[model samples]
Target: MSESGKTNPMDEQTPDAVTEADILIGRIVDGEADEQDRTDFERLADADPLLWRAVATRHQDMASLCDEVDHEIAMATTLELPDFVAPRRAPRWAVALSGWAAVLILAVIWTTMPQSKGIEGLPPARPVQINPDDELTFEQHMQQYLLAPYVMGELDPIVFRVEELPDGRQAIHYVRRIEAFEFLDADEELPVNDKGHLTIDPSELHAPVGPASIAETVH
Candidate 1:
């Protein structure tokens, strides 16, 4: 198989040398051979009995390894495992008591600490003593009305009258109004004048006494 009259040493390779038949046999054993590779392997296997025996031996070895692995997995799963105990949780009442204890401790710490008198260069705050006989100023009355829990939205204060008292103090009379909306059925109609304005009766309405009154006297 050489250009010279003598035979080439490379052409007569040893049995250990890898050939195309060996590669095709390896592909077939590994299950990676396509239709063309399978056809080629079949042709090679028919030509050589040794190659066919090698592939059959490889398949038997693979099946035996798979069976051994499956047996190991089954034995591992069947072995007795240690019992797992979950951590116990505290009672609801105990948790609540601990929270209250923390709050009490914080309260004690806060109360025991020295209270600040006043900021530096600023005068100490004086305690205000309110007299029941004295009428509230306009600003004080407005502040009280605004801070009331029932008050909502903007306050529409209409000054009805302003007069000077005998004590040289001015008295202001005002009506505090609040606008609100209510959902009604389609058939329900509000009483409106010819001017297309809703009319409400003042006498039919009622409110809380003292600072919460709609109409109040402020000095």
Candidate 2:
């Protein structure tokens, strides 16, 4: 008798009741039973102790299999990896630029470094030419001098100018590099010629001049 005052359905059911109960028990043991399936199975097996023992046995068997597989994997050796090597080198211009940057760093360090007093028998330092009213320190002036080569258009990497065509495509204006020596001597309206070759222009050699600002004011 059930709590609903009706005879238990399983008590009057046919032999198919055992098969359906077995299927539901398999779903519960495999962890695949839905909420409704689990609820029905609990209610159906309320008076049956043998069905609970079967579920417990199935769970023990699965746990043993999992432990066995884990032990086998743990006993296996670690995988070996191959040695790696770099596969590319920098271009010539990039290498040259790197060398220039190294030189600039070394020059800056040498200029800003304090003289060591512990050294004996060193030659007297040469007098450096600098402006009386200029706000720049000696190290700053040295750095400016070292950077002048790039400022004077001697080490440009852009060998050509990119021009946009009327049809919305870009074209390269292949211009020759204006050597530092040539740029110091020639007088021209523009740096590039009609054929897109570079012509030395003396006027563009100097640093850009503007109205005095707070940066120029001495502390």
Candidate 3:
């Protein structure tokens, strides 16, 4: 009552608890508060716009320090101080004076954001492209000479192309060359510099190689 019998706006608040300016100053500036202290500060801020503004000014005095706090304050490892979801950049001096609070904010941001540690170690891979139109598969050329009958019914058998295979015999299309077919073992997937050169199946073939049918290799 202003030490007299007159209605005062502040008379409704706790006399010894804290002043509105003091509550805002404590909550926003110094960040010291108990449960009742925070409640009192909230009520004061709701009732007084000047108190809220004063608090904002004091907070921004430490620019980049005022940030988005977490939804539940308990999630903040350093209770009372706000949780920084996204780090704000400012002059080093602004955060420099705040001690570990600044470090904590930066740590949270680094953990949450996508940042590369060893970016220089990796170079982008080159794309491999093949022009499918010009390419010919081994099966396509098998018909040209492998089955051309020199003497019909004089011992003929269907031939399989093995040019794509390295351990493979010579081409049947050349001369009277008769290519022999062989079976490869399970462990016989030999690594080759040119993968197209090795087309032997990892599993055994239907028939094992005996001798070249004609006689000596033509080439």
Candidate 4:
């Protein structure tokens, strides 16, 4: 595309037209060069026939290329490229990333929401388990005031539950306690006397003498 052996340098910037020779040759025969290239083309076309022929051939080549390019451009303008193939339907695994994103969003909401209760109301706080086996710690115990004015009598000693003790002898739980008082005068006592009075003394009252006792008597 050279004209009169001189080269044009500005065509390098555009990708499709890369040579100054192309531009120089394009100026002749068609009269379509820019103002500056036109002046240069006229100078070269006037001085040399060889330059004119070369420019004509270059012009012819450019026209043929232009027609070929026009045909390609017409086809490109008319034809579509199969709708860009729809990017291959985006692979099933790739679409699943949206699910992962949704899960992350739900997790964030759960982490940030207030937690005053469970899904319903949380069970009332179990202050303590309170095993209740630790020997029954009694907070209070009520007892009759035995030393009152007229109440004292022959009250038997109150019994207690003999709970299991640590030393294994079974200590009493002290669940009840009573005491006798001296306020009331007694008409009768439990026994005739603390000594062996003979209402039914052990020596006199036998259980009809068991066989062992009979045998002992014989022996």
Candidate 5:
């Protein structure tokens, strides 16, 4: 305070200033701040080094998390499922159950079944391998297992029974299981055609895709 014969603004930091700075930091992190907001944030940072440091730390953490997610998605795109002998699939059930329902049922049955005394009674389970030259990483393999149905379009509304609601909305009920993750008893509302099939307007997919959108032609 004595150096310039004036009180420092940083020394008079109020609770409102701290709250505003936090809001600014969140906006910056989310990439929602405007140029003027950025300018004000910088001004505040220059006035208070501690505030700048706090923002920097949070930014770095968020960046690291984003990198990790990107890495997982990259892995998922390249991963392959383990080769296994196909078992007979049961006929499709009329009602949609959670993704893990069938798997959990099988697991329970397998656990309760009597074990064979002879080694030749059942085939030995194949060993899983993940060689970098020919196989995907363990993480990638897991991601593949979890996302296989979604990737293959098996989780589409067409695959599940759709019920009409009293309000003219269609309820799509199904479990989309991905490895250990289970979308349990999940349901979604969808528009339906006169034939009672799920229908989606292409225009609703994207603003630019609509016939009336001028920005689409300009682009």
Candidate 6:
């Protein structure tokens, strides 16, 4: 097996010829050995106490290294930056003077600018008179009149009646009007059931429900 006459022990040992003790020791080191395997390894280690001490020291070193790595990671994640400095604010008089200065500059620019009349060789522009009534259609005027009461909160429009005109056009009319009750208590709240109906007694229709009653029922 060698150039010399003597044989080498490493040359005689093959990958397939690995001993069971080596396999047991490898499994224990890799944390893959079961209870029976660990027991067998313990017995083998008893034969060589130095080997057991070496393995134990290696395990302790690995655990310490893991803890150090974890500590480094935690420090990196929770790293903090220095506090930011606040900017100095200007005095009240300075701020007011700056505003006034800006206004004066704008005024001076506006006054210095020349007003445009008409382009050269073009006719002079005439002022166009617009009528307020001509701006809105007849339907828009009717809508404003119909919703005036509702907008004022005096009455709410309920029924809408649609009628066909003689010229085949349609006209809508708001028939019913009712006043909505305004609750005095701003903190008054009513709960609704699964069906979306208010969970209130018929006798307590006008009365406001307090938060204590609702909390009691909820608890």
* Per-residue lDDT of candidate 1, residues 45-136 (tens digit): 57665667777776788789988997878756544432121113422211211110111001112222243111112221223344534544
> For candidate 5, what is the TM-score?
0.29
Query: TM-scores across all candidates?
Result: 0.26, 0.26, 0.20, 0.25, 0.29, 0.24
| Candidates 2 and 6 compared by TM-score, better number | 2
Candidate 5 per-residue lDDT over residues 1-219, each given as its tens digit? 221122345547742233557767789988899998899878877877676767677789899999999888875654444333222332232222222221211111222224312211222223445443444432233333433222211221112445666766654443333222112122535455789643653223222223334322332
Worst 10 residues of 1 by lDDT: 97-106
- Residue 126 of model 2 has an lDDT of 29
Error of 6 at 44 (Å): 2.1
How far does residue 104 in candidate 3 sit from its true spot (Å)? 31
Q: Report the lDDT tens digits of candidate 6 across residue range 78-183.
A: 4433212111332221121111011100111222224311111212222334343343332232233223211111233323455566766554443222122212
Best by TM-score: 5
Listed per candidate, the RMSD to the true structure in angstroms reads 33.1, 30.2, 33.3, 51.5, 20.6, 29.6
TM-score of 3: 0.20
- Between prediction 2 and prediction 6, which has the larger lDDT? 2
Candidate 1 vs candidate 4: which has greater lDDT?
A: 1
| Residue 107, candidate 1: alpha-carbon lDDT | 16
Candidate 4 ranges with C-alpha deviation above 4 Å: 1-22, 27-32, 80-219
TM-score pick, better of 4 and 5: 5
**Runs in model 3 with CA error above 4 Å?**
1-19, 63-219
lDDT of 6: 0.40
**Candidate 4 lDDT, 1-219, residue by residue in tens:** 344454345445553543544456655546777878867756766765466677777678878998999887875654333312124553222221111011100111222224411212212222333342322111100111211221122222223444454555543221122221121125534333567443422222222235444433433
Task: Mark the 10 consecutive residues where model 2 has the least summed lDDT.
Answer: 99-108
Worst 10 residues of 5 by lDDT: 101-110
Q: Which stretches of candidate 2 lie over 4 Å from their true place?
A: 1-18, 75-219
